[model samples]
Target: MLKGSAILEKATGKDGTQSNHSAGKLLMIIECLADKSEPVRLMDISKELKMNSSTVLRFLTALVDNGYAKQEPETARYSLTYKICTLGSKVSSHIGIKDVARPYMTELSMLFGEVVCLAVEQDREVIYIDIVQSSTKMLRSMQRIGHIAPLHCTAIGKLLLLNYTDEQLDHVIADKGLTKFTESTITTKEQLVEELQSIRWNGYAYDDEKCEIGARCIAFPLYDVEGKVIAGVSVTGPTARMSIKQIQLKLQPALQIIGRLRKELGYTG
Candidate 1:
């Protein structure tokens, strides 16, 4: 509910102290940019923050240099960068999912003898929050914490996207452009929708070397207390070791684990 200048003012700190002036100003500029739905001009930021144009330009330059903000040359307007969202997501996933899912991920790795991953959706991309290496290490995957995979191809990504409404799904797919990572990747909206229907009916999803050439992944959705899909739990390995039959067999145990995990997260449904 906060507006541009108010956001800037509050970023100055709770005590309204000038001790951390530079840091506060930087945060203020970020908040001001974040408050806007689109890029804002230098004069707008300066006027909103009650700061001089020169000071605003200096802060903007610093922010742009640090990859936190970008400027449009023709428009001369500044906007927050994807870097802010990426950093925020990393911090959030580290603080939230990793600690809670670590034991479960470890158990999955031991049981399946394959890599276990915990991930959540962000901007239609799946970001792995935690990973447990395979015990055998013979069929390990390339996924790691903070790795981003397309929502239409990866198992966890599809699991997360399955919960989206049709309109939302279409928007995400349009924005992300379904870049094919492998021959098996779903490149058409119709194909993806059909796959999503199957995922819903099966209560799980499979990558089937769709994200990478020789990797296979099976993922189950994790729900929050509200029965909202909050994240996904997946197992990954080489396709040779995780063939279609093998993935189908692993789906049951994965479902059981996800059911317990959902309950642990207070999911009533």
Candidate 2:
């Protein structure tokens, strides 16, 4: 037991008691699906969460009943339903961060001649919320809106890390140790801290051939109304065409545009 955890247990006065929140249970079931390593089985949920099989079935039945999920009759396996996407779309529309970032991301790709991506912190990683392609004719990937990436290798990843304190950054490092992809990838904890510190001061990041060999990326912190850095936007391109300095000099103006869009959305900063 850590010092603060023992203090918290004494204060809360019921350390052994577990929370019985239904919403928490539902989310735990969803997370259990992710751990199955294959299409989910009810047994996986029960075993992983240590909940009763009957209880897991009942919860899953309720989700299936509501169209939030579905079970395969042939296999007795369950998966998220199409309705989840509809519900997700409805939720994303009102998330405020995604709504505020769309136009700036669009304009950045148009101005930079590269692919622009907007991502938000999900757990200790980044989930792509929006992507704007530079041109249809250029070598471009169809951006999947919900794809996730490591928060230590990509430009947007490091940009988000800029907001963390020394201790929170330590937690991130412990949760997801730095993984290397290319020769330039920062694989150590201290190096990431130094990089984030510079990003905090310079207000932008340059990922030089880190995630992919030929790819170079640059990103900046996106502030909400109160100047809180909640998310980030990045522009990616081939390293052959976009040099390190060019990423900073040519596309650095995207920061100003993103700042204006945030302001329009009532972001005071």
Instruction: Report the number of the highest-TM-score candidate.
Output: 1
Q: Give lDDT per model, in order.
A: 0.79, 0.73
Predicted structure 2: lDDT: 0.73
The weakest ten consecutive residues by lDDT in model 2 span 1-10
RMSD to the native, candidate 1?
A: 9.3
Question: What would the TM-scores of all predictions be?
Answer: 0.68, 0.63
What tens digits encode model 2's per-residue C-alpha lDDT throughout 136-246? 425444235798888898888888777788899889888888888888899998788788788878878888877778877888777755666677888888877678767
Q: Which candidate is the best by lDDT?
A: 1
lDDT of 1 at 32: 98
- Give the worst 10-residue stretch by lDDT in candidate 1: 7-16
| Backbone clashes (count) for model 2 | 2
